[model samples]
Target: MIHHAGLIAAFMDGGWRGALIQGPSGAGKSDLALRCLDSGFALVADDRVELWTSGGRLYGRAPETLAGRIEVRGIDVLPAPALAWARVSLCVRAGTPERIPEPAFTDDFGLRLPLLTLALLESSAPAKLSRALRHLGERR
Candidate 1:
């Protein structure tokens, strides 16, 4: 079940679950995902993600094509631990801009997941993402 277009995964809550970031190519998804992982977020999947909707709810997974793989520019693809496929809460779609500024928005499949878009150039994007995740959890 191919998710859609472009996406990356991040494991949070002690690997209990994860969030998926859906965006287009060259949107700096991997770079942002990597930064988030470096700041303690685990990589569930990068590149291709497989999604499924059941019981009027949405679920997602990493396709076998790009499971356990994280790409780094000018470097090899880093392997990640096995993920038990979790539900997605938030989807972040950021671009390569100057600064993160404030949290942005991302919505898909009729579900509005307030995505926190940040410019990849900003070194603090991951930190902001982490904070956004925490805020999301608290709000939910």
Candidate 2:
């Protein structure tokens, strides 16, 4: 079976396989996830995603505990849109200082996936997330 690391934020509506947003705590991972959701992406799991391997493909599901709860800072915990099960296709690590240089690709268990490192900027995160996801889809 596919073994997953810690928490993962996956998208469900854009494609069959989703992107796993990973990073150290307080790196805005959840914030990015929220932005992605606002940009038409479904939340698979906010803080936990179950990973499994089948037929050489890796899939993920939302953990029951944090399934619908998405933290919105001052807004209190909110329920995200219903999630869709999906296979994980990409893993993005959060950058310190809120931003990182635009990355090209990153390695995951020896496999390479395109990178869209977060550069901490006050710009529209949702729009940026949408653009990045669209780019990712176009690449495949």
lDDT by residue (tens digit), candidate 1, 33-80: 777676666666777777776765456767787777877866877786
Which regions of candidate 2 fall more than 4 Å away from where they truly are?
1-17, 96-103
For candidate 2, the TM-score is 0.69
lDDT computed for candidate 1 = 0.63
CA shift of 53, model 2, Å: 2.9
| Number of clashes found in candidate 2 | 5
Evaluate all candidate structures by whole-model CA lDDT and list the values in order: 0.63, 0.59
Q: What C-alpha lDDT does candidate 2 achieve relative to the native structure?
A: 0.59
Please provide, for model 2 over 55-95, each residue's C-alpha lDDT reduced to its tens digit, 9 standing for 90 to 100: 65556777677666777866887876655566666665655
Among residues 3 or more apart in sequence or in different chains, the pairs in candidate 2 whose N, CA or C atoms overlap within 3 Å are 2-52, 2-53, 98-120, 99-119, 99-120
